[model samples]
Target: MSRLDTQIETQRLLLRVQRAEDFEYFAELQQDEEACRFIGGTAPRAAAWRKFLQMPGAWAVQGFGMFAVIEKSSGQWVGNIGPWHPEGWPGTEVGWALRRAAWGKGYAFEAAVASIDWAFDTLGWTEVIHSIDLDNVGSQELAKRLGSRNRGRGQLPAPFEDVVIDIWAQSREEWRARKR
Candidate 1:
């Protein structure tokens, strides 16, 4: 099996490779107005279908990508969160997008910590960034908790290039220091 098919578990959540069964839950997240507002706006199921497959494709092409975030206790797909860096991305970003119901539960923080550790220790990434919209206060806070800080402006691949975002990041040395 591909490395993406492997599973990474936390105390309360399971991070696994994205799968077809996750489409419905992912579509629901894409349809959530509040959750999608910063990530790109609510998308129709057809659009969500195309977007949903991107992570798996990323894994095949990049060897690493977002993981399907599942609630351990409930066995429900909560969202996707992990290292992502597509063509023309500002940097390798550890991003997250959870369903509305999963908000304020600390899941993002928990999963991010684990993902960042993997990116640094396993993937040997020197650093990680979070391309967050200026208005995404929640993600900003999460980035802060991850020991990242707003570095400067950032750009995304075409179609999203016009969207403004703040680059929040930290070096592996910084993250290692924080862990000590």
Candidate 2:
């Protein structure tokens, strides 16, 4: 099936491959200082456009990438969450980033659960990781809630090499056990 044909639904959200129509929402999140702080700092419109395209590109090349999350009730683009592993990435990861307005609603956690399940069951991954910033307490908590513990410090590639991050992860067996 085409990548676009792939979609997963939760009680309140729809997770699917990124599409052109989602770019505006993607760019908006990229420009939100608080929302983008942990993921990457805010970007200008031009730069946001480039950054936004990376999801689809990754899906095309890698068969998996962050899914554009949509709120089922309002049918609004809420954020991005799912499998992501780029060149020189620390490991296969299940990451998340939501618009500021979507915060405090448990959307990230819900979407992340589905994403991690997909990464393991569908993608046949043995393990999953979440590379989180040191000061991003919110994400750290979310990672913990998802049954991941900080494995230790890890390095990012090139431009991000200087940035310190913690690798939070769990094996597929661990995840399956938790879900039981």
Candidate 3:
């Protein structure tokens, strides 16, 4: 197994290990209600820190997890894009989130394409899933761009009500074909 910091680089971003200092920006981003509106809602500082600390373990156990997406040009942690294994999904789910300042740019799509390609080609993952809330048009669009076809409603239930997430997925073989 490779070390956690074996940085994954794309054309414009570098997905790397989480640092303690990242939580400040991570918490800030997570606290943004608009930024997290689709997933659920933002978390408090303490909760966000807990989540950040837990990420490395997830990577250790599953060989993958949400990675801090850093913009190589400025060395800023712009977002996170990778496989998410939230309970309820039958398969491994791929998810992403970026700060509001990073929106409207091609960052999300670019990060996703790289992750999906690596998940299939390099990492040897069989398939990838996406659990996106139905009304999260931005995420839904991003999933589509990744060549994932809508599967169905997600297991993310109430307080998250009215937010019946849609599932999207693609297999390794499928992803390879799409890239050609």
Candidate 4:
């Protein structure tokens, strides 16, 4: 199996591959109007199920995908955050989407740091980007905290092509320097 299948542990989070049992949490996350507001709109169970499979399918086909963010204290799936690059993607991205309950807890920043490290160190990526919606102030702030800067507006592939987004990015060298 690919090394990307492994897990990452932080003080308060567990970043790992998606599991069958995590689907329930994933579905619930998708259905959360507030949580899904920026990432995508809430979906019905059937649609959520299909969208949920995208991560695992990406792992199987691309050897890397977003990691399921688990809250260590509760052992609950809190969100998905990590490397993601699909067909016609804007760029190699380190993205995130957390449950509304997980917000304002610094969990996203912590998990994103680990994911970005893995992307550059293990995946040999030279840079990482976060494709954030125009109005996602929280994420834009997180990107700034992570030392990423908004490069400019970007376009998503079809179905989301009209959505306004900005590409926040930092190079591996910049990340390494910041960590030091």
Candidate 4 lDDT: 0.93
Tell me how many residue pairs clash in candidate 1.
0
**In model 3, what is the error at residue 148, expressed in angstroms?**
1.4
Candidates in order have lDDT scores of 0.92, 0.93, 0.78, 0.93
Displacement of residue 91 (Cα, Å) in model 2 is 0.4
TM-score of each: 0.97, 0.98, 0.89, 0.97
Q: Supply candidate 2's per-residue lDDT for 88.
A: 96
lDDT tens string, model 3, 43-152? 98888888777667777876777788888898888877886664444577667889887898798888888777767765678999887777788888888888889988
Worst 10 residues of 3 by lDDT: 154-163
| Candidate 4 residue spans exceeding 4 A from truth | none
> In model 3, what is the error at residue 60, expressed in angstroms?
2.3
Error of 3 at 145 (Å): 1.4
What's the count of clashing pairs in each model shown?
A: 0, 0, 0, 0
**Could you give candidate 4's per-residue lDDT for residues 26-115 as a string of tens digits?**
999999998998887999999989999999888888889999999999999999999999888889999999988899899999999999
Per-residue error for 111 in candidate 3, Å, reads: 1.0
How high a TM-score does candidate 3 get?
A: 0.89
Question: Residues 16-53, candidate 2, lDDT per residue (tens digit)?
Answer: 98888988888899889989888769999899999989
Tell me the spans in candidate 1 whose CA falls farther than 4 Å from its real position: none
